[model samples]
Target: MGIPLDKAALVGLFLQTLFYGVFLTLYWLTLFVLLKKTGIQRQLLIPVGTLLLFIATAHLILEFVRALEAFVFQVNTLGADAYYSNLASPLALASLALYITQTILADGVVVWRCYMIHNRRLLVAILGCIVLLIYGTSGYYVVWSFSRTHPLGNTYISITIFYTLTMLISVSCTTLIAWRIYRTHRFIPKGLATFLPVFIVVVESGALYATSVLALLVATLTGSNAQYIMLTVIPPIVGITFCLIVLQVHFHVGGSPSEHSAKPRGILLRERGVRDTDFSNQPITVHITEETEIVQSDMMRGKNSQLDSEGVFQV
Candidate 1:
């Protein structure tokens, strides 16, 4: 038999709390790295990242409130089942809104990063448009689904589509970004191959998020109460992925050669004025600050190069 909804909800809350702690640490670390290394700029990533963290915070608070109501206050009164089954509860509605909003925003950021990294290629632009449309429409249906007395019976297909599209968005964006990195890697000087591991780590980190979403989709489609746990965990997982990219880029860009001396000869060529043949023709302004720099610089260094005699290696 499936796990009881009340018990599942409680377990989900516990797991969510654990992940939220991790997310908090990473988010603050990202901010510290940015402010310490690169002062604030016009980078679009700051506001977007802040907004996502805010949504996650609100979601966690709401989840705690719901759990309290279900297990503590309502348990002896209306009963936990009554509390969990009441889809119209303010907490439930708010949680749904936050979840959908985060989903759209997170997916949109991934697409935007891909579009920018590829120099706004028409193909990426078209894909981004399609992604936003699906997310927007599916989000609307998700909200609508809740209004139905029997949402599972009336809107299961819509819900399924929403999760499936989210998973696709994650997988597609990760694949495209990884491919771009791999292709760009071919043009980089052999001395800079040391950075390849870091790049690969970023791509693999993204793949992990995609995998998490896939698991969520599977659990959702299987009608497993475990979906509750995945749902609760996703917000933090998203934050973790975002922070991992930011931190990885920050460390490589700001780190000293002595620290990486054991690794390879050309750890970061930025200080050495080494320009790849592919980037010699491009205009490069090196900015080591901001989360977007991870994509705009490290991922596509050849297209974006340094112009100063100071020997600032681009990317």
Candidate 2:
């Protein structure tokens, strides 16, 4: 049983590597699409993408090291119990930390999006901050538990529960963002040919990470060995979900009729200083008067997804 468990871990690690390859490819394509479509804003985006790749690569390398430790080092020395025992080795600690960091960072990005989607309302922002604080605090304990060189009693289980909470925060914020975006998109009068795809991409991307986390949460709660496999797969998937959201938004919005028609269905970018991520944090409103119409139109749009305030079509 011990030998087979070790083998299962090894095989899981191998599959994780293969998954990494697929995601790495998507990351490059995502980066390229982001740069090409994002215009000057690529400065902020490139750094985020680079960080994602760096974290993802670190996860793979650290996991590979853990695999070696479990299979080669332990087998050659202390036998299979060493493989099963939760040794607080450097490689394991680093791997654990990397996974935690990836999940937290990805959640932060989604929370940021949620903040913006809610029009940067102080209430939403405050709630997001609270979520981050809780997530960070819980994650600290998780790492602290790992520092003991092994999970003491139910320490690992506690860590798993905390991790689930962190993921739930993501799903909650994602739901809010999606609902907000959907409500806003209901207003585009014509040539919505663009926003629908963006909407689908956003929803699907959110679903991607949401589903992964849900599965992760379920596996952890069920005490299945498959939890290890899910953990290995999640970091890259989170990174991919985020990049795809940014990439798809930029791709569809960048190539919209705004380029050819010179007026992009009345949607005009709001003047906000230094837009973060793909777009500004304010919803783009159309060039119109009539407060009633403006209010109605505003309900149908989101910030930073239109031409510059100067009326220049970016890219």
Candidate 3:
């Protein structure tokens, strides 16, 4: 007899599903906030945000299908009867289609953003061609797998390859951009730098959705309830936790003032005539002192001076 899902496993699965839904919603909301806050050109974010929105929608659809499947098959196993009854459902097929579309869109967005940021036009074109090839090949494999009732093997391999490539490209681009920005800017604002790593992790981890799909496929193939529970519960939890850690790190790093800013001398200088040359650039010290009846030789020394109320020489 096959191992059946027990009460604890059922509860665990329900909680995992709930968390997945909540996280997906949060991801969308966060993306919107970033879109509003980012100084990067609006055109760039549009494609990225659209891709994220589509992926979130796909996950929601997948969750719905899983919930419906659980309700019918788990609650009324005898009534459902068919081993692959859920597979036959229109909603299930629609969810699968959406998932595939989401994968393509996600990969495309990553490649496009990377190429755009790097100004690598030729490489971008090459990546675009690669995406098309992978997507087409994956679609063919998926169709063949479904037709032959062997989706588990073929779909898993194709999706994994696609996701791995996407993750590699995105991470490389993000790290390069961050490093370049750090090098070029004298003082990167705490807020911006803090926010960047979090953004990268969140976006890159979107590929975890593909991992979850592969896990589900494996569980289905093996008919293992334990495998299903493990696959469904672990990846999202780990991925989202990493995202939250990145966010927390950003908030702390960006929120706190630098040691240089916190110095006693810096505090005193703030009140003096000295002021930051450019608020956005490195802070430079400017000393203002009083000078009366400036000496001709000193004046000829090419040093600039300004007179103050006190009749004293100041430079």
Candidate 4:
């Protein structure tokens, strides 16, 4: 809780570097998947993802520079505290700006996903944009307020509100998306690329990002030095979580031949329907098929097996 500011920054920088490596790997993988699987619509997603990665890169580089200034350049002369505590320094202000930008972009992606999945409902879109507006406004105010040499006591409350709104936006949008996907999963026929996997991906990715935000919020409220570490790691986590949803959803929809062959033999006879939607900012095509045949004989079948209207028979 009382960790030295310089020490906390050092740890945060180290952890951010590690997380950035993971984010880099996932970003490249996402690119590979999108390029391989998507068509012209791929343009819709790549720029946003690339922007996030770029911000993360800038953030890490900035942290490295700041760390150098605090530990190496300033330590022997002005002392590390001088560099670490000065919120108005160019590096300090720039770092906060990057964090806010990354947060806004990441939150925008989630809201976009929500809008698309909800059939582009005007209400959803409007509300999401409104909240995003509030989030960005409050976030910048917090940044500007903190940069002041003598911030008022209410500045802490503003910071708390900023993070609270972030968590709520993520949770609410994700819940809406998950609910919509769940409904679609229930209404649609089974054995034709189940939506459950998509549901799981949405929930997991959402939870991962939300939990990181919650951790940071907790640390901030508690006045723990760990907030520095949490702050450093969140940018990369946002990228990582988004990339994961894209990769995993890509695999579930149509993965490599080996991944496909690993599943039980099932013949999809006819395409019933296909719905185009956006997932984690990527275009996803969902195929609904009718009449799937599982190629397995009844070796121990005292009960007669027959295909039902839905496709498969019970044992």
For residue 35, model 3's alpha carbon misses the true position, in angstroms, by: 6.6
**TM-score of each candidate?**
0.78, 0.77, 0.50, 0.79
lDDT of 3 by residue, 31-76 (tens): 5544554344234444544554555455555654565566565657
Q: Which ranges in model 3 have alpha carbons more than 4 Å from their true place?
A: 1-21, 24-51, 58-62, 73-89, 128-132, 147-315
Instruction: Candidate 1: give its CA RMSD in angstroms.
Output: 8.5
Scored by CA lDDT, what does every candidate get? 0.69, 0.65, 0.45, 0.74
Candidate 1 per-residue lDDT, tens place, 246-294, comes to 6655455455434554544332334334342233557855545453344
Model 1 poorest 10 in a row by lDDT: 306-315
* Candidate rank order under TM-score: 4, 1, 2, 3
Give candidate 1 regions above 4 Å deviation.
37-42, 150-154, 189-195, 253-301, 305-315
Show the lowest summed lDDT stretch of 10 residues, model 3.
306-315
Pick the winner on TM-score between candidates 2 and 4. 4
In model 4, the Cα lDDT at residue 207 comes to: 95
- Candidate 1 versus the native: TM-score? 0.78
Winner by TM-score between candidate 4 and candidate 3 = 4
Model 3 local distance difference test score: 0.45
**Candidate with maximal lDDT:** 4
Number of the candidate with higher lDDT, 2 or 3:
2
